[model samples]
Target: MMVANEDVQVAPTRGRPATLSADGIVDVALKLLDAHPKDELSMAKIARELSVSPPALYRYFPTRTSLLNAMSAAVFADFPEMPADRSWREQLLAWQNDVAAVYERHHGVMMLMGWDDQLAGPWLKVQMPVLTLLHSIGFSRLSLVETTSWFLAATVGLIRTYLAADSDGLSRSDLIEFSEGLGGLTDAQRMLVEETREWISRGDPARILNLGFEALVDGVERRLGSLQAKGHI
Candidate 1:
């Protein structure tokens, strides 16, 4: 199952053909997941799709969990890194854009984020620097742990808000329908959602990410000052 070009702006024009080996089995599984959810996928299904017996697959994956672990490791193994000298906000904006670009380029890879330990561990290791960067910049004004949590919510919140949006991003009209149908939003609340949606739709998704991330950092700056003044950092 190739990633549809329409779904991701960066989906590759072609894929490397896999030979029926350990890497090959994992590669095919990754492709197959583009169409099916994780729970619905199994080695037997993969074997059938590959026109090989299930036992033949054992030479590669050994077990389903191991295959997933391998997949997780592969996704993060060569993920990009930021340069050493940029300011914190610049580095973080780059970090957010980098992850978004990675997900767009690899297609279904981000879905593995919900998998168990094997998937979670390596993924976090790759992305942890973003959190550490925030902590380093915020310093005593914000506890590293709490600041990291807020950063996660802010970044992930922005990503999740429109990750499903396509190349053009979401439209104000789309959000209008949602706001109207999903009643109980006061006019002020509805207006806020509409404005946020419009801001997101203004350009490529990276623009929305930048705006949201900067707003988050600005809020952090404010809170940090308040905490310091109150002797609570």
Candidate 2:
């Protein structure tokens, strides 16, 4: 679920001048992000929202990317550690769901970070925990980088694609037609129907996203089986 936007921030000192600490700045910046839609957020907008000079805002975050990194860090700081009691597949799916929730809230934050190659630390904080869980689970057919890339492509890539399309309004009819047009495919209708069933059951960004999650978990199980057969785990 999406979080409600809160009141505009002031210096937290109560009566006297509230110090514009990094945390406070981040608080206000996050507010601005929530209040505005994608591409509408900027340093100027944030400064105006906070009633601070743009240069004053720049003092802490030298560039817009830097401030965004801080915002991403602040968001990631809340992600829970991996659940030790759960199986590795369970833990990894749960972590990806949590990451998806955060990315949904922030919308384009990750894309912005990608644009500048910024905030490697917080970004890795999300990736490493899951990768470590996979490693602990004995997944080694693909290198960590390869597995991580594939997982992100499924989860984050799906989210970005949905957002870009304004909720993946692409009709499954088209998909089914395309599959039928692929020539001699015996199970084309069944395959496309099964794939699009979740989408048909509900709406974009959640139903389809859950399907992607299941696919990732299935991939992990397959990799685990392969490793076990080879005595690699």
The weakest ten consecutive residues by lDDT in model 1 span 1-10
- Summarize candidate 1's per-residue lDDT along 1-233 as a digit string, tens digits: 22111211222223333556777777777766644432356666776677666666655555656676777777678777876688776776777777666555454555555464333666788668866675666554436667667876676656655564222332222333454544787888888877777664456655656787788767667766776788775
Candidate maximizing lDDT: 2
In order, what lDDT does every prediction score? Answer: 0.61, 0.63
For candidate 1, what is the lDDT? Answer: 0.61
Model 2 bad stretches (over 4 Å): 1-19, 112-115, 162-208, 227-233
Per-model root-mean-square deviation over C-alphas:
8.6, 8.1
Residue-wise lDDT of candidate 2 within 63-91, one digit each (tens)? 65676677778877888887889877778
